[model samples]
Target: MALEKYSTVLKMAQEGRYCVPAFNTYNYETIAWAIEVAEEEKRPVIVQLYPGYDFYIPLKVMCDAAKELAAHASVPVCVHLDHSATYEIAFAGLAAGFPSVMIDGSSLSFDENVALTAAVSRAAHALGCEVEAELGHVGSGSNLDDFATGGKFTDPDEAVKFIELTNVDALAVSIGNAHGAYAATPNLQLDLLSKINDAVDIPLVLHGGSDIPDEQIKQAITRGIAKVNIATEYFRAMYKGYSASIAAAPDKDSLFEISQMSKDSVKEFLRGKFNLLKADV
Candidate 1:
């Protein structure tokens, strides 16, 4: 399968009944796993890399690796940059041939966020890349401290205006979803999600999806969410694989074992998630 752009996958999600799983990839291991699952399931998927995540590594390696893996697959695999805080990182991802990039200015004021997102949108769009901007600060932490972010919520009215002015390809709203794994059960604000979906024309994204229950996620998708970002669970799987590799053999076993293990774990995870996403060729 060819690597499609984010817009193409998102449009399918919107018209279809479920969302597309956007898995975060930090290295070649996770990327391989994502592509494997996407191919097996024959579903469109988005593989994203966060800012400062293995920043020392070149982006081309990641892109080329994914491109190679995607070449013979049976599904669409789109690469993206997730939670980029600066124009430099965003531009790098675009120049490196990522199909999509997200500028997460949710930490800034409304006006500032709009300004930055607009600039990023222009830059990315000019390069034939899709841009995603976050509105309302989805707290930085996944625990009780998430509440301390002042419960940053996206007002439907503001979301409408922001999308119009920014012209972003997608909108990630902070409807009670935070980053990282939740220490407790998260109470997703479905009402806010409904209002935002009703107001915005583009696809809505749900972050911190790893911790949310199946029912909450299913309801959110039914209400009009097209993208779901997952990270912590995959991270946990990668760590567990490494630990198991060490415990099983103290010798200098090939690191590829750990990499392959992580990939398999994440593949299983994506299979389940895309099932919920109702992935179909």
Candidate 2:
């Protein structure tokens, strides 16, 4: 098996009426765990690297690691750079061999966001890569106030215009979804998502997949969310594994053993998530 393009996997998800689970990975343990679960479930998965992670894990290193892991996986896997806030970082990810990059200009004005996303799209398309653009602001979930005040649902009409102008392979919508762990359970705006879906033909993406109710997420998939990003839950799963391992055996200090334990925990967590998405083997 080889690393498949993000556009291809997303398309499959879109047509299949199910969303693919995209897990954020910063190191070998996380990346390996995601791919291992995807292989076992026989489902296509996207391994995403956030730009902020570059401080600890270099972009090139993560990209190379994802490519290598995906190359030998039994199921299709795609490498993506998530929420790249700048063109330079997005370009660097593409150059580093990521098949997908997100140009996040959601904070900017509509025109500016369109211009920035369009420029990145042109460059990415030229290199046979896919570009994802965010249309509305998906605020941080840690701040419930921000969730109420900062977030704006994507306008169906604007989504049509933005996708037309940017030529993005996927459009990330903010319809009552935020990033990070939710302070409270989210009530997804599936009707709004349906409107956006009706307006645009490209695949739709949902961020802040951690705490949304499973039924809401399933409804979202039915409405056209083809990709869902999960970060906080995966990170929490790894932390729980580490805590349990140290508590059970305080004297155990083998890095390999600890890493394996952590990976196994994350794999089990992902298996449940994959099943939630109705992923098939």
The model with the greatest TM-score is 2
List candidate 2 stretches off by more than 4 Å. 149-151, 279-281
Q: Over the full model, what C-alpha lDDT does candidate 2 score relative to the true structure?
A: 0.88
Model 1: per-residue Cα lDDT over 121-205, one tens digit each: 9998987889999998877544565633336888899999999889999999887788886766787888888999888889998
Model 1 residue runs over 4 Å out of place are 143-150, 248-252, 258-264, 279-281
Please report the TM-score between candidate 1 and the true structure: 0.91
TM-score of each: 0.91, 0.96
lDDT of 2 by residue, 135-250 (tens): 98898888775455534778999999999899999999998889988888788887888999998899999988888888888888888888999999999998998888777777
lDDT of each: 0.81, 0.88
Query: Candidate 1: RMSD over Cα atoms?
Result: 2.5
Model 1 clashing residue pairs (backbone) = 1-73
Candidate 1 weakest ten by summed lDDT: 141-150
